[model samples]
Target: MRKLNWILALVLMVPAVVLAAGKTELTWYGHSAFKLTTPSGKVLLIDPWITNPANKNGKEDLAKLDKADLVLITHGHFDHVGNSVEIAKKTGAKLVSTFDLGKALATYGGYPEKQMGFDTQGNFGGELNLLDGEVKITFIPAIHSSTVVAPEGSADKDIHDGGNPGGFVVSVKNGPTIYHTGDTDVFSDMALIAKFDKVDVMLACIGGHFTMGPKRAAEAVRLVHPGMVVPMHYGTFPVLDGTPEAFGTALKKEGAKARLRVMKIGETLTF
Candidate 1:
């Protein structure tokens, strides 16, 4: 009876152990904003535009974000930099960005000066081992414009050079690797991403006008070959008319094998 009880206890613990292992939580706050919680519970915010127009609960979500370990910005666009200053002030999250963009934000964009430094800043083709090696982030290039304009009514309300636009390939220890493609068009170099790492999830922009549309984005997926693709940077305004339906049709036409996971605004998914 004692031996049987011990076996049963071990069986019961298996599920809990598996649940605790290899699990990462991802939350979307509309547009290109995402919150990634690593397996060890370290929180990383990417393009943390928590108050974007697509999210109905933007204010509430922004208020609830009281804990963040890192705040990563892809460029200097107002939409992408949304709420970074506020979140940094509230959570004391360190800024991860290019040296130029970090300096511009700290000097003019109102991000806490102390939160950004060389330890967290890097340029394209550079990989940063952050959070005590819980996450490895590689800076990826994007073909897009970047410029930082100080907040309206601020003393130095002028446009500043924000370095280059880019993306991130975030590899989490014991968890999935994710690629966040910032605003960009289809480029052949995107194929290089798969050569280095196997991406489990891809946060892609499918919006037209400013970024690639569904057709072009599907082509990009074919090049990167991620396990799953999440469409974003769309539907926030009337100008961004790309829809998931179009993206899906384009994916099928492109014969891309990646599974499309379209997340709703304010939705959370665990991987």
Candidate 2:
């Protein structure tokens, strides 16, 4: 009887350990950006452009960052790469950007050039796994531009277009796969991405004047058909004056298959 009791206790402990080792969480930092936390507590930050007037001291927030394992940059734009160098250095996270962007960071931004993990190179349709296959992030296509400016406001000759622009499809360990569309207009290929990746959560950019507005974004959500759709890239600048309320209304009107979710700044979502 004693042996049987001990065996049952071990069995319970095994599942607890597995569950702890298999859990994952995603946090939205707004503007087509997110942080993925693996079950083992490894953190992967995608397009961490976490600074804007709306952030309320968001620049200072970088100093408090901890456990940043990797930093993924969607493009070479200033907003997207705003604090990439600082966060990567402070948290000792690898900077994952295009080969050109990584080189620019090392040459221009004084980042650790050797630590960059170049995933995109002016094209798309590539995937990389991190943390011993605990998570996988795929680089997809976006129809935008890329640029990296030098400290002196001079353009770095080494700067490459790094494709037009892009986003990522992140697959967490035993968790939902999230697709982040980084500053893209509505395109027919979005539907193809949905068919291919089967995204679970989509962090879409809906701020007009640069990215898609509410109407086109609604079409994007419908085409992607994620389990949940969260609007981003709005209320940051005057040009991007879109609101989640408008996006939600459009989603409903369009009869999007996915649920529309609105999150406050610094909020997190778990699957």
Candidate 3:
């Protein structure tokens, strides 16, 4: 009886150990903003527009964000760079972006100069091993434009070149591989992403006018072949009329294999 009891106890403990070791948290704060917490407790914020119009509790959420290890910005647009300076100042988080965009943000956008450096900045076709190899970030190309405008009433309000717009492929140690497709339309080269690493989750923009709509975004899903897909950058303004329901329908029409995950504003999920 003692031998049998010991075996059962070990079997139960195995599952709990595995679950605890592999858990990763993901939070969506509306628009294209996301907070990703790694299994090792590292925090990464991407396009942290925490106060976007789509989020009802944006202010509260922003106030509570006292910890951030890295702030990843994909472009120079006002919407994409939303509240990044404030968050970086408050949390002392390092900035991850292209060199030109980093320079523009620091010089005109009031982002601290000491927080960003070559160690964290890179351009397309380059990859950086960050956080002692806990995370690997690759700069991916995006078919879009980028321009940074200085804050209101600043000494210099001139629009600065924000370098090329791009996305990121973030691989978390012992966690999932997330591909954030910054503001861009469906392009053929996206198929190349799967050749390097299989994408576990894809944060895609589906808003029309500024970015691709439902049908084109579905095509993007087909190209990348992510395990799961999350639609973002929609319904913030009247111009961005894309809907998750429409995106689902388009995914079905395209025969994409990825599971559609439509996260609500200010929702968190563990993987």
Candidate 4:
């Protein structure tokens, strides 16, 4: 009886140990939106453009989220900022963005100014240590214009100009360093970012009309040479018609080291 009891105890303990050692998961919410859950159980949402046509079921999905720890905004575009304030209010998540964006949200968008923290501010080339220990986020340059559009369809450009559109290299505790490139055109700065940050996974935008097309974005991916590449910011509107199939073909032709991962609207990829 003692021998049988010891074997049963060992068998149950093995599954518990494996569950305790949980790996980080990457869930795609579509249209430049992704949720990263670290091993320590911190949730980070990046450029969440929920409610767009590309999202398919974004607005409905937002209501189901009860815990969002940090929200990172690359620019002040309406699509990217969609549901940010609402999500923050609902979940008590901290917003990570430029100083001007935070100010604009508080002054114009009526966000609670009290929850805003000093860690919210990060410029191009700046690094921020997340509240979750050992996870770090570095803001890199993106060659794109960023200005808030008013309800009347007029551009609200200012001297500050909402800083600049950018990307993030997020380093999780025991997981890979994931890079998310916000809306940008092909620029040499991407090469610099690649050299400085050894990205494991890259979320690059590949839409033609507004951002870099398939060909140029493939070049950018080659320059970065991430382990895996995921495409975003396309197929949402009539203007943005670039497809993932084209991107995959180009990547193959270029002999890029990165593997292309084309996810569905609400797919989750565990890293």
Structural similarity to truth (TM-score) of each candidate: 0.93, 0.87, 0.92, 0.87
Cα lDDT tens digits, model 2, 136-197, are 77777777787765543456545534335788888877777888888788888888887677
Q: Which portions of model 4 miss their true places by more than 4 Å?
A: 1-20, 149-160
The alpha-carbon RMSD values of the candidates against the true structure, listed in the order shown, are: 3.1, 3.0, 3.5, 3.8
Candidate 2, residue 74: Cα displacement in angstroms equals: 0.5
Which 10 consecutive positions of candidate 4 have the poorest summed lDDT? 151-160
Candidate 2: stretches off by over 4 Å: 1-22, 118-123, 151-163
lDDT tens per residue, model 4, 1-271: 9999999999989976774687888888878888888876788888876667877687788888888889888887777877777788888888887777777666555455765768767777888887646579898778887765433233644333566678788998777899888898878778887777788999999988879988889999988889999999998888888899999888988788798989888888886
Between prediction 2 and prediction 4, which has the larger lDDT? Answer: 4
lDDT per model, in order? Answer: 0.93, 0.77, 0.94, 0.81
Local error of candidate 1 at residue 168 (angstroms): 0.3
Candidate 1 residue pairs in clash (backbone atoms < 3 Å): none
TM-score of 4: 0.87
* Alpha carbon deviation, residue 182, candidate 4 (Å): 0.4
List model 1 lDDT by residue over 1-271, tens digit each: 9999999999999976875675799999989999999987899999998989888899999889899999999999999999999999999999999998999898888899999888899999999999999899999999898999887679886789999999999999888999999999989999999999999999999989999999999999999999999999999989999999999999999999999999988788998
